[model samples]
Target: MAASARIFSSANFNSHVKNVRFQLPCRNRQRLHLRSRQRVSKLSLGSPNQRFLSLTSFANFSPAQFSVSGGCLDRIFFGTKENSCNWNFAPTRISDGPHGGLFDDEKGPEVTVVVLGWLGSKPKHLRRYVEMYNSKGIHAVTFVASVTDVLWFDLGKKLEERIENLAQELAEWLSNSSNGRDRFLMFHTFSNTGWLAYGSILVNLRDRKDLMEKIKGCVVDSGGDPNLDPKVWAAGFTTALLKKNSSAIYPSPDKSTGPQSGNMENGLKTEPKETFSIEPWMLSTFEKLFSYLLNLPFAKEKLLRIVSCLSTDQPHCPQLYLYSSGDKVIPFQAIESFMEQQRRAGKEVWCFNFGPSPHVDHYRTFPDVYTSKLDSFLKKCLSSVASPMPS
Candidate 1:
């Protein structure tokens, strides 16, 4: 529960503030979205060790009227004058570490994949995926969303604007290429947080038909739940906070079944065993809390709208879904149902069910198989973009 900052402004604040810090009570960890049209930055109030905390304290606070000031907050952001915000929770490992050369080795005129990390995920968490794409000669832009991002509804406008700016930059770079090589954009999302981030990008690019057409595919890993579920949200937060110690039941992989040949009808093959690391009471409490907050008339409507847009208002491109039965966060059935829905709508869809990989850890557990499926799908997508179907 580190005091992460979500900046929504330029670097002007960086010069004005220095080493200023604030603290919220340990019991009251709220993700506040402080936004001002002219100049304002949102900061998360929590303890130094607390991560992926809660929103219980701000039941009556207003996102607009609330304001905070600090320089340590400024240390969290690295933005140019033109962009609202770029990265989230600027981790030392990604900002100044070896991963600093994240987009260095671009290979060819192949697609550029935007790797969006899950809630409470750091840039280091996505370094492997970025490296994979980089090794394949594909360019990548890695972005991680904070816990504040997924819990609230109205706070995403700045985030949306930031993503739109990124899309615009990529489009400009592609347009300026002297080689006239056909380039494309693709999204590789880790969990529901990353998937929602992708949805926000689509929302911004919806009007830019040219850019929309350039998007070739989306790779959904461990998430594609079309609708918001309280239980899933609770589980996701639990996993983010506790990491490997959470209630995830990681069963052995059923090597007999391949990703394409699994029984798609059933969800989980065996009943999950309970883990004592995260107590059952704690999970149920989180579920009850989220159920109330998410069901509020305004929050419910806004969240549902955001999710529904992902289903009907996306780019016309092929989709690849990578999920597993061992995931304790998002249910595999939800992903399969979404895939079936997309297929029925005539959109090109593909999926692979890694029988026992943990949520968002399929690549870590089964690197060879995961990369094979991803490589195959990416190739197919690039080929389709190169030779688009006759409209």
Candidate 2:
């Protein structure tokens, strides 16, 4: 068998991460409270026309931690030094590129890179990506959505309100910037959670052609499949939950019998499932229940329509999709088909299939290849812009 074929025979890492669960508060009412390690937020759903109220409180985390050495702290915290709202922006110097040096000194066009991170994505992880963009003289802003946000989407509850709020914030931040009108916009989204947020932003800006034209391109990693199987959805959700509540559900791995010694067939690593035992029947039952709920009259149709819009209604710009065949949480065939559809529609789409790397683990498995592809894509996006603006 070919490497990809042999790898298909082995069980995936989903089995190792499948046992964790978090008991959410009752969703019977229209309100939900989500408590995280550093913050607590309340969300209230109202009538269709009424505005939804969401309150989030941050504790002890400082904006200073995000500041790069030569970057302005104000620019890092606000969209610009003049803005007062708490949008997370972090400006950094690019020492070697064409737009190299401090923002005040850079000689190239200013590009604003907005990153939407996946569920349970850590601040450190997001910061790393931000730094990468900063190193290229691109002003980077990042938003990390909590696991509760994904839960809301999974239940098809108040998702619009949540996405609307984010879109408004982003729109306001960009519109108010001193140099907003001339700046090129690019988005890098990680996983389905990020894709949801990105889709909402697109929906909110559908009528704003001025803003839409400013968007140069977008890069989607490990997600954005138009159709997600219920089983795959459940597995991805389970993985996110495990990551969020890692301290409670995942015991420290025994070095002797954990990931290190696990089998690696056809370049794909399979973790030992003994650490977390989830019966196959349990997964089947969960999938059935989830499918039933999702297929409830009108609900599935409504959700599918929303997803269809996400896949087909995006702004006409270049898009790059990075996915892996060994991603157990998302079927690679779906991604391939979506790419094909985009091509058929005459949209500019590029894809790199990194075979055998687990979901979102492409960078880890093939760092050089991943970085090379990303650099090429970024250059292509920049080349399409006629002129670069001052930061």
Candidate 3:
């Protein structure tokens, strides 16, 4: 990472941590990755899809059964669904001091950047981004959904209600915090899980034109797959189940040995080295199982609604997509096709292909390049706030 990129590093991360503190409920000691493996093994005893559907549909599945890794996971999985405290990845905060770059008084619009994290991502997974935005003097509110939320997104109403509550909070914040000066909202999403949650927020805000006008742009990172294809769903779910590490099952592009030892900003360890390979048959089986689960009538309908909302209900704002040809989870063609569609609809769009970065890990791999592109896009979006860009 270059010196410019290091501007958004551990220092800002710690600053935010100290400012926003929440004492969450006690968590279970058992690690979720271990339990997930055991659950997968148990599924082999019966039809995988049938077993999964039974678990999701039955109200009898205990909190212990769906347990995740830390106190954050316990709060998210077992806490009251409608409580805003349990759902957001981090509490919202405004820029506490002056910033130097694009957001200087006359140069850019005052902006609030809402960052949505990928599926199964913990708060630690999103720390870098919070640092990135907050260091830029931009307010950031980070959010992530549990695997259970994504798995049953449309089948149940809890996630929808939580999203609505989030939207309401954003609306209130924009209204109250503006101080008579123009303030804007920019959405930054990671992977499909965040992208879909972004869509749900759009749905909640559709009827509120005032808040809709406050949205100046969106940045979609490692996402924009706009269909309900089971294969893609299977790939995403598989990655989540294996966890987001760059092991053999989810190796980095170019196959270089990953970082062995280094401390990232915030004292986070570098990615662990690859240790094992996953068999091809496991992916095939998961795909077959998802094909059955996703095709169920109610599930299919909910998925279609999500896809449709993203396509038709989005606000008229500039869009930027950050993705890579090297990503195994999301095919590059899907992103290109989606971008082409947006172009045809006369929407302003920008994209960056970080040639060999892994899904949602572009910043970690190429922080300089990632921050450079993002900085450029944010400048463009703010520059065009009061005027339309020429096609």
Candidate 4:
């Protein structure tokens, strides 16, 4: 028989080892593509829709299971809701970090990883993140849930409903556990979809003071552009804006326009009310570069009330970013814009830019580099995160 053609993926090229496998995509079940209605924003949600997911929700490595090859699978045990590993074709995120074994000490350093990925990304990706963390002795794990296509669907009611599900799941996961490495960190990918969901996570954590306290830092990768990103729907934006957005002020929409003639800085928000406010797609671009959006976001005046934030509310945490020069889906300057804003706000930013590849494919490229950087980032968060531990 023909040796099943040795097919290699983007990940196989960067690293010598191939542990994770992205299965042949099924029907566009969880849509990443979106269509718009004439008056898109006005639709209403009929009845509450339900997509029930439990620990065993992912059965055959289908949309929600991560298949780890080599010895990586042996190092950790995945306790799913069912008796065995089910493939959701996606990945799963569960808890099992550096604060490993027994929690003899009530407090030391604890880390919670909030995993986010592209819209169509399956559960396997989530599991891979957990597995990588486990390998590092990070004692990190995640609660799993599926996300609705807010960017594409723009179904506010649907988005809200899905957000509640994720929030409830997260709250339940952290409700009784008083483990050490309680500090929280977000592991994200994609652009608008993840951030839209993140907005809800913050809203959900608002009432839970303890969970709020555990949030240490974030590692947002390849996302965060709402209005300024020239990519996404505008795939040719690089050239389109190449004629305009001069990287001077606001990046002129056309080259003829002399470098936007006004104050242009970094550290802005994506609020709907700000004059010349940013849109979500642009925010995604900002997430990929400069670790601060290359340029600032919004204006200084609007940041006072934290009014112009993308979130329906604002989440205050020392946030960081990850970007790459090669990612086509998300531009690199977007990350710079993020850091620029963070620095302006007097917050610190820790960035991890792993080489380059298509959109959010860092792991497939330099898995070791990506893992190493995360290890260091979490290590630094140790002493800093445990201070004034939440009682």
Candidate 5:
């Protein structure tokens, strides 16, 4: 037998191992790389395995890149093409205090405000609420669902899936961080759109006792309307959509809808009857279409069931219902009935009627009263939690 060439030099060993690692599958490659790195550190040019490692090729090895943590996957899945997945969930700092900055180790976060914003909710508007929570030494996370998400899709299934994913993500986030577990959690929901998201989250957390227990309370603003009148909802949807994408969707607004105009404070506008018109023919057409879809045998019933679950499920925490008699979107009668049902069920429910505020305009209409009510409700919820925070 002829003598074979021996290629066991230090240089050869390093190069070969790199090549072999690359040739292996992603998962296996990681394990092998770790093992090989360890073995190389204790280089033994004489050992069989170590010698074999030296000969293996590493020509194709590329370092595995990790996905950026804290980047929102929801945005990528839901946002517009131009800004998709570019969204980040960085908590806006509202205060610096002794309790534990935004997040703490021993006592957990002081509070976590999860705001489920209504359709057409602008980022700046949502930020104001974040600032509010932060001022109170609490952390705020805002999740805004797209209007199209509610209007176009089969909301029952798609919306539930989206919300369930959000719930799972939230649960994981809380579990992963030391500042999460003992934190007092509350949801501030806006309008029926917000309730859809909130209710879906509750449904997902129903069986998750651990996560459910963390919820201290919830605040519902201008929401939980039981009326499933397609025409009413469709009109609201059209107005919101038009308001949001007016220039793009209705370029010549003056000719089309009399130059759409309303309160622009937070995109939560009180529609002026005399100002805008949706082309009576088109309005009637859409109304009829929506009516048919909403009237599907079990559509409205299923939605009511979900809302019922949201009211009765887990933790049984106190809830603050903020609505107005003058709000055309969600009828005052509906709010009264819902609150009455909760009270009859022995739940800690509080109702604040903003006499004439338009839909979602409760805060703008009664700023001082709104803030006071929110402050009181949050304090009550936090005080009730068994976990004591540092004074």
Candidate 6:
């Protein structure tokens, strides 16, 4: 993980750090204030392959103490609409890469790798993946949707506005800046939240040619099912059952559905339910919400249509999906079906299975194995973009 030279400084331990803040303060009922600031840079992608593997080995480690040497991009980011998300961009030049040192020149691929996930997403959590990619000279954008943050809140017009507002802000950001959209070449994501936000943004980008051109490929991590797997249900359910956290990612009908659409009954196909403390009432609750939402006009026509950005039937751009076999959050079958569907539709899909990791646990679960695969994916994306294309 620490293949690079080791040097620590007092100010950021040799790393440039930046904290971007965007608050739409209502000075007046009819007005809002928006501000964007850039700091030096933050932590690097720590143990390149081991960060997202999901193990107890990293429990005591601290990335903040590690010094990072780099710069922040002149860019804007969209946080989870719920006002609970954080977006961190760490730019650094690999001192020993193809360009001799760092990739801040036009000769390099104008690459910006954005990580999409939950609002609580921190670079420290994905230090390895981020570090590795940056070491190879690609920019990293880490963001999350605070779906879980607002799950416990009561649904209403305000919630809808909050959700759409986040999406719109991202869209507007891409649409406004110079080379804002075209500058980004590839994306690396972890978990279902990335897709939820990206899928919606793709729909909006259709009208913005500049923004559309920037997104060439996408790598979706743990993007299987939210309301399907039980371990995930248990994790989310624990929040609902104990902390009274809503656990609802997208809008759903059933209060007890608790995300994942209510499928604790079928994890990995062989796991035992004897230990399953789930109740029949939970299933009924999920069906109620799933049935209602699936039937709603907005959901059926608008939501479903917008949500298809992650669908296999979409344009055949390069897409890599890394899912774990042991992921307690999603049934292996669900992701398998998604990959198979995409392959049958003539799209490129890279698939790898992490041996029995926790639900949505990418780092500790399959750190080195997955990151290596991702390294290959990044190289592929870089060549596709950096190399000359024929007419």
lDDT of each: 0.62, 0.56, 0.62, 0.41, 0.55, 0.45
Model 4 ranges off by over 4 Å: 1-110, 136-148, 151-153, 178-190, 207-209, 228-316, 384-391
lDDT ranking from best candidate downward: 3, 1, 2, 5, 6, 4
Residue-level lDDT tens digits of model 3 in 290-328: 655576678777767877888877778889999877677
Model 2, range 94-174, lDDT digits (tens) per residue? 355433333333344567777887665655666666766776656776665554545455455555565665566556655
> What does the lDDT come to for candidate 3?
0.62
C-alpha RMSD for every candidate? 11.6, 14.5, 14.7, 18.5, 18.9, 17.2
Clashing pairs in 3: none
- What does candidate 6's lDDT look like per residue over 32-126, in tens digits? 11234212223233333322211111224333433222111100111222323234343544466422223444445456666665434544556
Which lDDT value does model 2 have at 270? 46
Clash tally, candidates in order: 4, 4, 0, 93, 5, 29
| Model 4: per-residue Cα lDDT over 251-270, one tens digit each | 21222221121221221112
Candidate 3 lDDT score at position 381: 74
Worst 10 residues of 2 by lDDT: 1-10
Which candidate, 4 or 5, would have the higher TM-score against the true structure? Answer: 5
| TM-score computed on alpha carbons, candidate 1 | 0.68
What is the lDDT for 34 in model 1? 22
Each candidate structure's TM-score, on Cα atoms with residue i matched to residue i, is: 0.68, 0.67, 0.68, 0.49, 0.64, 0.57
lDDT of 1 by residue, 1-391 (tens): 4553432223443332222222432232222222322334545456544423222223232334423233222212221122222222112122233222222222335467888887667667777887676655466777665544454333345455455555566666555667666677888998997897788777767777888888888999999997668788888776665555565645445433544433233332343465453345446655765655676566677667668778898788889999987777888889999999999888999888887766887776677677767877776787654432122
Give the 10-residue window scoring lowest on summed lDDT in candidate 4: 31-40
Which candidate, 2 or 5, would have the higher lDDT against the true structure?
A: 2
